[model samples]
Target chain A: MSTTLERPALRTSRKVPPSKDSRTLLKSQIRTGWALLAPALLHSGIFIVIPVVAVLVLSLTNYSFGDTWAWVGFGNYADLFGDVDFLASLWHTVLYAIVVIPISMAISLAVALGLNQKIRGLSFFRTAFYIPTVTATVAVATIWLWIYNPGSGLANGFLSLFGFAPNRWLADPATALPSLMVVGIWQGLGTKVIIYLAALQGVSRDLLESSEIDGANRWQKFANVTWPAIGPVQFFVLITSIVGTFQVFDLVYVMTQGGPGSETRVLVMDIYQNAFQDLKLGYASAETVIMMIVIALFIGVGRLLQKADAND
Target chain B: MRRGVGLTLLAAALSVLVSSCGNGVIEKSTDGVPPAEATGTLRVLLPSFPPSTKGKEAFQKVVDDFHKTYPKMKVEPDFATYKNLNEKMSTSIAAGIPYDVMVTGVGWVQPFASKNIFEDLGKYGVTPDVIKEKSTPALIPAVTYDKKLYAYPLIADARAVALRKSAFREAGLDPSKPPKSLAELKVAAEKLTKRDKNGNITRSGFDLASATGFRQSFTTFLASTGTPLYVGGEPNFDNKAGLDTLLWIKSMINNVQPYGQTNAAQQPLVLTGEAAMGIVNGGVDCSADGIGQKNCDDLEFFRFDSGKEIEYVGGDLASIGSRSRHKDAAWGFIQTLTKPTTLDAIAKLNKKIPAYKDASNSPQAKSNPLSQFVADGLVYAVNENEVPSNWLEMRGNFDIQLTQAVLGQKDPAKVLHNLAGQSR
Candidate 1:
């Protein structure tokens, strides 16, 4: 009885003061953790954090990659708001995101569901779907450019087979943005499909079986079990999709160059033109800040939706 | 500990920002030429030479020739393309390592000269009279900014209208007498245009090429009307001539040609037989491998004659950087570049006419009929230079806004007005 009471006291003493070895081990673990993280942390600090800060500082000035620059304190921001070209680019980017995100997400999810089932040539289908993601955007865009050629392209040829008139897919102002959106969707599908495939595979098989036992139909099984289980992944995909569509540059740059009267001029392309072409670095930085904020707001809304979904 | 790390990172970032804010103004050096024995590297930024093995070998010969003059000076070449030339130059300027010499294009002098990036070649005895005596006199205006010669011409890129003799004959027009005026050309084009049963253009009568081509076509037509797009950094086309030119272009779109169509190879539509007639560039190949001699013989080139007969001329120009320590060496290098043998090789490589008085006699010009025609036309060439310093920025805006006007999305008058406003 006395020994047992001593054991309790000893345990209390041990809790009060961790041994020197334990303390050293804890400290060493933290040191190891920080050591492993240092390269990435340093990279982020230098490339991301520093550039963002520099851009913020530049947005307040009239820096045009020249020697002399004067501080204008939000003047660039004011100018950006009034700039018609920039406003159009913003609207184009927003419209692109709105059209691209939901459709791409739905199509990819459907593809992911179909591929998730035990099927023949599963690996081949998976690789085929992921090939576009790995292909260089420039190469893809060039191929698409050929495919959109009015006279000899596959797109028009396919349309001709359907007894439809040949459309100037990228050349017409009416069709240019939509044509780009199609390329954007097709190019983005692979990554989203891969992500959804992974998330779908992670959905609890036991939960799905239980839903089926409860007389749940196919749609009901997906709605109750798979969808809820993949809610976090859905949020992740939404945020990524929003960011990706918002920052689209190379595709449009190669394809149309924001031609046909700036019909396909997206935000990043406008920023690039302002910064590099017009030599208006400060104004471009302000545009970049606005773009970042817009993307953040979209992600925030996505987060809210995910939280509400979780509550439900 | 984390707070300390955060503070350290913040301080580091702020320091970087502060350092970047340092005044990047480079002091112009008017010092006399470096001695022939100077050993430092003489860096050159040029888009004139193709970055290919053959191009490099040809450029190396030029460098070897320069080495004969300055045997000790090492040469560094940055063969950037025209599309990325501005980016490379701006980055170099920001980095405080501006090239010793830069090769740019026509209409680039004013913008770069305004920024004091180029050294006034006047100090080195490059006067308008000297250029007229030694080079194509018309390019003198292109190299002059604020009455100072900022660049020396390297080659001439002239555009002339070409028509297929067969197409002309088929349309019941005289094959020898190509359309000389804009009005005549429009009529000829309408007649030559071929359409399918569904009313889609099977063959464009006049290929404006695409939206990008429209911008150049506008310059070609506007200059023929005795007015340039811009004069001394201001809009010269905001009046009647500009409106008429734009209206003419708008009228042609989807009438004589499709809105934005080009052949599969992106070659001149006339050359590819995609269009009956179009504005052709300085050079064409009539070899067995190219358009072939028989087909080439069936084409005729002509200049636009409205208020004046003129061809749109643009060219690569060599200039010394203001901050160059070896201005003398740079000038010597440019002189060698302008030599007949070197210029001929560069012209051949670039498919341009040598910007010299005797350009028509250059080997490349003598071999290609189209090139020879362009070289002969260089005498009456009018370029898109002598414009405002903001012309480079205006070029892009012109392409987009002009497209809007041509597509009938915006009124032609308002488009010109807005472009004029933007140029300011």
Candidate 2:
């Protein structure tokens, strides 16, 4: 009986210290929180939820742009499996992402580590690196077009200085996809570098000092101390980078146009051709559905990895 | 603290997302009155022409003249480049706020008409007979679908060969008598081709594998070669003429380095004396009005003897939107622009051949010798039927296969065979 009485007293002391006015204050705080979140929630519902639902509905029907529509019931999705062009595009997109993500992240992280050092003109270097991220994609693509010109472009001109013959950078089927990969890496490096730089700055100096005292080499120190400290950022960067690379359309469009016999064609470009050029909205919606599933799978795997890292 | 920043960033992102998604706003007209009795503003869309200020001024002047006829109504003009016109029309129609009247490409009539996005001009007194009388017979089928006319022919375009006389003289070839047969053309090309010490072609004899990709030029070649592209609603490129044309293209491709040149390299090649001859659209002015007077002074049109004398005819067309509230006003506006004098002025300013026969034979058009050639060529020119809904996709597929063959990636016979199989 005495033990039970003590438990009750403990429970009361922990929970019941509020008056009516305090309870009112708590309720108002909850209301304020919801009010602050309302605009974003509404926007997401309108844009994200509605469009996703519409695409899902459209995937089940032959929904052209105007009033004509019919319930096809899995017909579009079934047809996609038999589409040789769509399959080829899917394969190309995967290959592109596979090549671009690792190379892009590695280079960006390397540059970010270099920029994070106690070096002179650090701000200028960071600004210079970030300039490409701010430049319009069209402008960048146009400049690169001139640079890739075999006869008079800067790329061939540079190769000529080393006694090498000119190369058709964007024209040859064998080289076009890889050439675009290089452009993708170059254009994407800036944002990743900036993000990694911020994450690196947040790394604890005391941890680095202790690791150094342990007589760890630079690579070992980075592997043990810096990388673990920025582990979450690395996962975030990898996820975003993969997603960005999977949706690459502009560079492929401006440079190769999926040319030399569709060697450089990717998923998004294929979707565009079907949707706009061919006016196959129903078919395009189905393609978009496939893209959404791919992106979801990628993000799902990233989340699983993120949870696994947390467990570790 | 980090949570607060994350939410703030999320809010910003959501705002951008909402801004980018379309709102699905539609036209607000609920009036039951027929467009003929209604009075309102009319909108007209035209293609970006000549890429010059004078070209824009000429178009605006025509709009201003149309506005002069209707004092109570206003004419609003919008512009889009030829490359983007189809997308603009499709999006506008989808949004239900398409312009009252707009310029359309010859190939786009099918898609627009099939969707009922364009007004059937037959309902408004413009019939097939009217089109046959006013426009070339080749253009009659271009704007008609399901025996209903959807658009009025506006400008005319055809393919022709332009030769550099100076290069011919340098190659010890006569400029006046150009090659009439494929054999003669190949011989002349061989004689005129120039090579550097490295064995690289410095000056090409003929720019058949142009940097613009080979589709447009290939179509012109096919027509001139008397190859049937289509027969009984089927792609029929597996015949003798087709095979011969492919082999000819392959032979041309082997003589020079292909695919490294810029998109507009052909015109500049002729201008700068890097290519002796180039095939170009009839509307292109390489003379005093274009590249330079001196470079094009000796530029003469060559007639390829395909034995059938066939040429590719394509052009911009004009049509009223089906959903337009002021359809009558739009028709009136279209009529005003298509008038003989207005059409003549547009053609003169833009250096294009007028669609109407009277406009083509006008005093101003007669003064330009090239315009006469364009008009004459329209008689024998033919256009593929624009009715097939999948024509664009079919054409795109054919272009890819042709490019593969031209680049030596695939055998021409195999490519054509595969293309035929796919078409079937």
Candidate 3:
């Protein structure tokens, strides 16, 4: 490495740069980049990669939070298929992801479109919508819980003026998931809207002007010009949304604790319950690994969709 | 049910086998020598609060007091919360962290004791006679299995209703009395309930019975109503009181009286005075002096005065672990805390009833509501250890089932029957 650096110094010049020396210099720079990156790589490997691998290994064991964990290969996985609870949780999580990811994307896109118009309060609107993303989960959850309260919650209280009976948004099994989904969408929209807004603003006005001149209506211009440019941004949001929905734990934990007779119970909730409440660490690890795989599949599919759309 | 039977028999057989290895009687210490005052460090572990903090400061203070008398042994205290305390303790013990004393709740005594976590005090020369008069040996049954005493039972925590005296008066009921039976309480609840024109309850007369959601409070009523949760070493929540209790709670929500809104999302209005009365944890919280006193100062206690002699009394019990390295220190702590004088001090200070029979009459201890409640319900206290692995998982299942029942999504009886079958 030192010899390569010396060679770059000795042979390389600015106007007639030595290709060999430049290549050596690049190699030396790359070596230094890796050296600097080692700590981060080591951290991710130890904290993230190693634990993820352990979860896969633990997925085959019999472990609760308190009980002495023991290896029982494929026991947890086998149990997962046979367990009605896990199946329900899996279904709930998938449905939640299916509903939330798309709705959040649409709302985000709408806000992004509005922001792309160069509104007078663009910065204020941007900050206002993005505020929820920065708010604490617990604080946001608490406020939303009040807003969703059946009798006196702000939502029901407002609805009551028109003679609507109080709806137990968080308590009713049917409403609970949707209520949480709304909150999730609300939280995601803040960040998603900003991303799409930036991407939309980056679109060339010349393209839209040309489309308009070619007799394209506002809707046609949007469909033909604006949307195509922001496809990559939409894909970015899509991948994140899909991955996030599968691992929804904190909201469920705080809002319902997977209650109304496990109606709101999701895969992540089951994993946490097994690990902490039931002290079944190994079993939880198995559930976690299953979630990990689901996330990976979602991201994989998301990437494919992005590629296909981009090609189109 | 099969697991329950198998575990019980295995435990019984193990205890018998272990006894056969010894002289059949577990003594305090293995050696024949008497318990002479020896000097060493004795470590005591508990949460920063009860069910360990009860005797902690007192224990340390007394240890200091005792050291002035003996000038020898040292007593050290360890504190953690109930949430992760047990895990920390279990991990520490499993990894040989050398925890000498564990000041834990009494419920854990049997499971860990049967597992031979603590040295049997009886094996070390602690005789039945010493425990009989000194401690509530009645608790030994919960702490012991197959004639081996594992944990030293120290205190009994009881649960009782803390009705607001002012609310009772305003509702045209006697402040001095509570409902004599579950049926009567339902009536009282009706009178206490205040509603808006929109049919929304403004002030709930009583807690939505499912508020506890199948906890010790809910189970206390189950037991009070005579639910046969156990029979002949078999599970027995298949009948009357169990179904009755569940349905009665459902009725309280769906028909007779629905008070405070069930959605906690509705900002629990009681502390804010929206609800009139609630069935609350009768631990120190209900005590006139415990933490809840700040908000519920006007709250007064009444044992569920079951018109019959059968009322339900449930509270936590403190016990020494069988695996404790500081068994002697623990015994000393238990003995001191249970003594009428000290028990009275704690009971009065915390505003709870003392488990010791004598503390009921102690001037300071009896001045509050809990002691009087316990005095009313002494005959009704129940201590059945049916499938007692802390009842935590079962509690979860029951909470969910009960929630469904309260929401009127399922018939209480049917839900309970399913829970009974599933729990077994």
Candidate 4:
């Protein structure tokens, strides 16, 4: 008879809803959370969402930044297909991203691996590598411009000491884009190295030791133990690098202005010319939309890789 | 939680989209008034030719003088480099916050005017008769759109090949008589070029790779030949004359310094005595960054021609903003800035030619031998075809093709043909 009475009490308490005061407290907590997020939400809405939507709407019409907008549907997008400059610019941007991202990643990773060793003055070396990443883009470009100078420049002067001929680094059509790529890679390596160094700390030393005890070589040990550890960070670095490469403007503007036969003309530069120089805001908006799609695709691939790495 | 976050984001995006579309509708300005009757603060935007250069001080003095002249009217000056002026002006104009009077380039006049960013000076007492009387006849076309005056021609510039007499004499050529023909220029360049033991050029004969060398040389070359590259507002770069000109330029590049060899290659080479002849600004004082003022006594100026005796006049213009409420005050400021006295004063200090005929031929300008050629070129100056709103676009296209050709990465004919097709 006592057991039956205890079971009913337990069931009644278990099935009971929250008190009015508790419910009100939960509602207040949610309101506070929302209130905290309100500022960021407003900031993103005003700056990012509004501009994005406006660009999308403008891309569909022949909007010239005024009340005069004719709904041209996808005419601007259609025209982009046949626009040689647009095609060339897109190709160059992709080419740049491809050349820069891997090179930067490999160099940064190598440096990170070397610096991960508890060597003398490691912190100083790490700081040295990261200095370029913190330096202003204009300041970096200006310095590189002098370095790339054909005559009396440090690059050619160094080459001359080794019996190499002076090169018109940023001026020749054959070498301008490549020279710019070098600067891009150099400037980008710093941040990636720092991130990889931080990520390297998360790399399990016990796993590596066990692999070494299993008679694995350095490459094999790294492949099995370390690569997986830093897989997520590598993916993050790659996505950021690709995004940065796609949006490179100031460097090109300061260095070449897309010169030496449109060799270094990237999508952003093309968009800039159209939007401001050509005053074709609608056309530029369409280009921006395409850039957004391309970047999204890249980010999506990166996310997939991250997920696969997580699953593994 | 995810649903709530998504809903909040959606609501935020919707509100933003609504606000963006609601704003940015430009209200048409109906506040333009005759300059004589205007009274208010005049926001003047002018190009500040670097502080290190005399151009900055000269322009500042012009502004100061204007302020003194119009004591009752306030003058707000915003200075920018020419490189950033186009985009800056466009953004300001689109935002309806343009200066009362702004500096404009020759190529920018039509594009800006057509976009309704410039006030029709013709409506503000700057009629055709007044423009012709005040500015050069050749320049009137540059600042005119649809036969209406849109801007005041402020400064005039022309390009000429300045031959180093010393280099010519050293090359066993007559220093006194410069090359009058393309063939002659090539012969002189071949003799004047000095190569090191490794076949690298130590000194160039004729440096065609100056700052903005290709475009400047190409324009001056075409103008000298009297060939209008722009026919009916379209770039006809595939024509026989265009192809011939390209080939000629290619030959010149091959004989002279290879493209992009030195920094600011032409002027630097010429000034440093490394180059025999090269294109330069028609200014006597245009000695490369240093070396004081270049003397006309040591240099001779000649048009790059196959004997057509033509020259292209290029320069900046001043215009009143269409959206400015102080149109009269802005116009007054523009008129003051463009006055013969002010033009002459600034021109003398900056070593640039004044657009005003009287100011250009004043005793001060006459004393400068280099200004003589610039003034003479104004007689045959050909305004760039302004009918196409894509003037800057076309120039950019041409620059790319020209670069490719100069670098010898692409055949001139092929580049020109491709450029023509792309431009079309």
Candidate 5:
């Protein structure tokens, strides 16, 4: 009786707590998250989503330089598939990607491994390797044109010393695409090497030392320990290089224009020439859509392979 | 070579100077009737440059005077580099924005005419009499499409061999008596060429292996051989004349190893003791920025070795755009620019012949040797495959075949057949 008088009478004004409402909570959570992510979503919708949708619509239509539009189903796609020049451009692009992706990755990985040894003048070496990436494509191509010129160019001048007939670097059909690939590999290697170098830092030093203490040879250690550690980085570089190679345009346009006769005419160049020069907007859109699908499928496959390797 | 063309053209051009200097107004009296109204602005576009900066300055003076004569109108000029002019024009026209006037090669006339991209001057006021009054009325047929004249004949240009006079003297060939035929040209080239030990070229007598060099030489050869670029709308490179042209170029490229060498490689070669001769644009005058001009005073020019040359004449021509709202103003501008007084002034400044036969030949045009060379070539020039749409494609194929032939991808006959097939 005395405790009751001291605590006073209990007033029950509040409603009872319900069971955890996951549905309601989820709805609220979604609201909160969407509010936070609205800007990025809006940006994607406006810039990427809208243009992509428009391209799809355009690809199916007879999009002319005319003020009005007339829709034509599958017309442009049919025309593009039939066009020989378009096919040639696509072939060149595929070849460029196939040769460049692996080579560039290997070069970058080699440089990364060497730099990972902590050599003297590491920064200088890094900058020296990366300098080509910073140069404008025009300047690079223009300078290379002179160098690759049949007569009085530095390349020919050097080749003369070896007593070998120096062939045209850009002019010759046999060498144009290969020469561009060399430039592409050089441009890409710097960024990739840096990325691998960063990834190498994350590998635990203790693990490497432990392997060394077990009397494992350097090659064995690298195969077992270093390779596994940088597997993710290698996957990243390979996928990106593939994508970059697929989108090759400026170098082809500036250097050879897919020339010595369609030897260097890459896919993006076809898209540009057809879309702009030829005014086949609908056809160009179809080509773009096809390119996107190809890149996506390839990337998906690349990711699957990475996962399989990890599991192994 | 480039120097020979430069020198000979210079001489031909100067012959006019002594023949035609009027103290006041030198034009022969004509029934000048294109009564132009005095108001509004007119516009013109061009890809090829007029002869000289001096000519441009003179043209401006004439424009100003024309403005004073009819103070209500103003005419403006525009220029575009040759590289992207076609694409630029295409996009502009597609957008329905057209310049009032343009100056381009005759190759462009037919395509635009077919498209009706240009306004019909005949629809406005051009009559048969006006065409008859003009010099080289024969050229009117070249501008005719669907039996109608689409453009006024401007200047005609052709490919000619240019060489350095001093180099000719040095090479022990008489500068005054240069090569009269292609065989003689090769002989001069062999004599003039110098080489280093280990079979390296020190100085090329001429650029032989280049696709452009080969094509120009090919055209000269074809004209001399009496073969047109086409026969009944089909390429005729399989013909005897065409074969000869192709073989001639192929042999030259094979002979001249390590073909290209300097910036002003061809003409400057003759001047700098590097080359004796070169084939280049036929006009006798040097470019204004002076690629081959600093020593151009001693350069020479020559007609291609034909029994009678069927010159490959090319140059800029002006046309009024169909969409132009200022038709009257445009016509007024054309009248002013092509008038005898203004034409004379322009010819004097340009060191080039005016497109107008009498107007260009009047005392002022005769004042310069380069202008006279331009004038001389006008009568004999021929244009076969220079229409815009077809010509662009033709040029691409020509370059391809020429390059393939030079690069040894295919023999001359094969290259010719391939080029001819592309038109279909």
Candidate 6:
């Protein structure tokens, strides 16, 4: 009976009229919440929202960074389907994302797992893996260009050690995209590894021990405990990687310029060529719109998978 | 109320964007010119000189000379690269602050002029005849659009083929009698090509120097066939000469020289001894600091003569912006840019030949044999000029489609047809 008397109220009175001071305090809290959010809201509105709206509106017109513009409502979009360059770029970008995302994720996870173990020179190895992520894309591409040099590149030199024929890595259309994919995977590994490393470190050790006591093997321990524990992080990595691989430009621009007969041409490269090179700003904006929609769809699919995993 | 405010803000933003896009058309300049005593800043965009310390110093010297004429006028330079010049120009124009003076390349005049981005230099007494008398007559058609001079010639960037005397002698071919026709060139290249035990190209017979694309080489070869890539903005390469030129380039790839091959440094293979012969740029450095005088002595330059003995020539040209209020000062600045000493300094810094009629006598040309050869060949220069307003766009298409043909990924005829359709 004393405990019942001492218990705090679990709910506010439904029909009570608040005191002036209480109402003012609530209003002040609301104001503080808004004040905390204002900067980020303002930044998003100016940078992201405004540009997206501008691009959407511009996509309906034939504006070429010139004085005169005429609205041809969806004509640019209609022409985009028929444009061979646009279609090719879209296919290349999608193919790049499909090939790069899973391989990069798996490789990064394996590396993260290796680095997570007790080892000598662990910090050194970790830094070595993470360095590429921090390096500038242009600088990385330049170094890779040297590495892919046909006659004297490190790649050819390595091939010669095994008595294999030298390959024109970036200059050959058959190998250009694959060579770029290797760079893309290697460059993107560092960040994903770091993320996965953090997630692997956070996997509950007690749960792993319990699984082991239950006669679980290493594979079972990982499948049941570690993998599920890193589910949210895996979702995050997948979505971000999908978005990143879709927007790859600087590497391709510096390395091949989407060359060897447009073999490495990606969506962003095509959009850039249209906007800045061809001076077709409106058509490029339409390309941008389609790219955004595709990225959104990818993210949506990722969300559905996350939900399914949670249900399981 | 929050939703209402959000909608209102978006509406305001859209209105602002729409209104901003409406006003970017540059207005024609009024006849009245600003006085020489003008005090405002003159914004100049130049891709002519690089943005290096040496480039800036050379450009600053010209600016100082301009200040001598108009001491009160301030000059702000945007030293952009040719790759980024179009981007900078488009953004500046959209922002309603177009540069007062713009220095661009050969094929850029028509595209910019069609949009009225450039002022008609004829109003300031820069006619075709004036250009012919003062500069290389070959560049007149390059700077002219609709029978009016839109730009003044700055520097001529020429391409000529060079061969090694030692390599020719080893092949038992006369070095002095360079191949004049494509057929002779093919036969000579086949003999000069060297192979390793693995059937790899140890030394290329003829380096196209086309790691990027065959467009420039195609242009040079096409001009030798007595046809330009485009004329009056129409596709002129859809004929027999075009097909033959594409076939010739394809047949040579991976036979004499590898497709899309370049030295590690991306320098011309002829200079690096990776090839017996190759197309070289306007100038070669023969100083001890460069490829060395010994290597230079082994080289001899020649022009292609299929139907015409034509060398590919491109150049940088300066123009006044139509929207510039400081047209007279801009014109004055352009005059200082074209002075003999200034032209020589810029040509030396850029490793290009001055577009002046007497450029062969310039110290930069006299010191470099390749520059001298290019300067003398300016008379027989054929440039990708007098093209349609969409030449810039067409050039990119040509680069990619031509690459496809050279790589054997596409049929030459189909590619030509596709390119012609794009031009239309």
Give the top-scoring candidate (TM-score).
6
Native-contact fraction for each model?
A: 0.25, 0.25, 0.13, 0.34, 0.08, 0.36
lDDT of 3 by residue, B1-424 (tens): 2122212222322332233345432223312222345555555665423445555665565566445533555666666555554545544443333355564553455444543455566654555555565544444455554466655544445555666677789889996777747788788878888877876666777764344354444565666665535442244665777677766666677343442255443323344355566554323343443335655566666655443334344333344554444566556554554566555555544445555544355554345455555544544555444444433345566677777766777777787676666553
For candidate 4, lDDT tens digit of each residue in B1-424?
Answer: 1122222223323433454455533433324543333346677787623445576666666667666655556676777767667666656644545678888776777767767778888777877677678776666777877677888887776656778887787778997788756667778888989888977777889876444436656655665566666655566557777777777788876457866655453354565566778766656654454444544456777766676765667776889887677676676678778877777765665566787756456644685666777677767676464445566667677777787776687888888777666553
Docking quality category of candidate 2 according to DockQ thresholds: acceptable
lDDT of 3: 0.61
* Candidate 5's DockQ: 0.11
Model 5, B47-75: lDDT tens digits are: 43453676467667756866755565566
Please write out the lDDT profile of model 2 over residues A31-60, one tens digit for every residue: 999999999999888756766666666667
Q: Global lDDT for candidate 6?
A: 0.86
DockQ, computed on Cα atoms, for candidate 1: 0.28
Number of clashing residue pairs, candidate 3: 28
Query: Which sections of candidate 3 miss by over 4 Å?
Result: A1-37, A65-69, A82-84, A204-215, B1-155, B162-179, B228-234, B256-350, B354-357, B362-364, B375-379, B410-414, B421-424
Per-residue lDDT of A1-312 in model 4, one digit per residue for the tens?
Answer: 354444344645466789999999999999999999999999997767766787787678765533356889999999999987899899898999989998999999999999999899988998999998889888999899899888778999999999898888777777889999999999988889989989998888889888989999989988788888898798889888878888888788888888777888888888887776676777877888898899898888878878887787
Ranking by lDDT: 6, 1, 4, 2, 5, 3
What level of docking quality does candidate 3 show? incorrect
Off by over 4 Å in 6: A1-19, B1-36
Instruction: List, for all models, the DockQ compared with the true complex.
Output: 0.28, 0.28, 0.10, 0.36, 0.11, 0.32
lDDT of 5 by residue, A1-312 (tens): 354446665577685565579768988999999999999999887656655776777788755333335778988878778765678777887788888988988888888889888689998998887777777767777787777777767888998899888686776678888988887887778789889889988888999999999999989988889889999888888788777888877777777766765667777777766554444456667888788887888788889989998888
Worst 10 residues of 1 chain A by lDDT: A4-13
User: Best-fitting candidate, measured by lDDT?
Assistant: 6
For candidate 2, give the lDDT of residue B194.
82
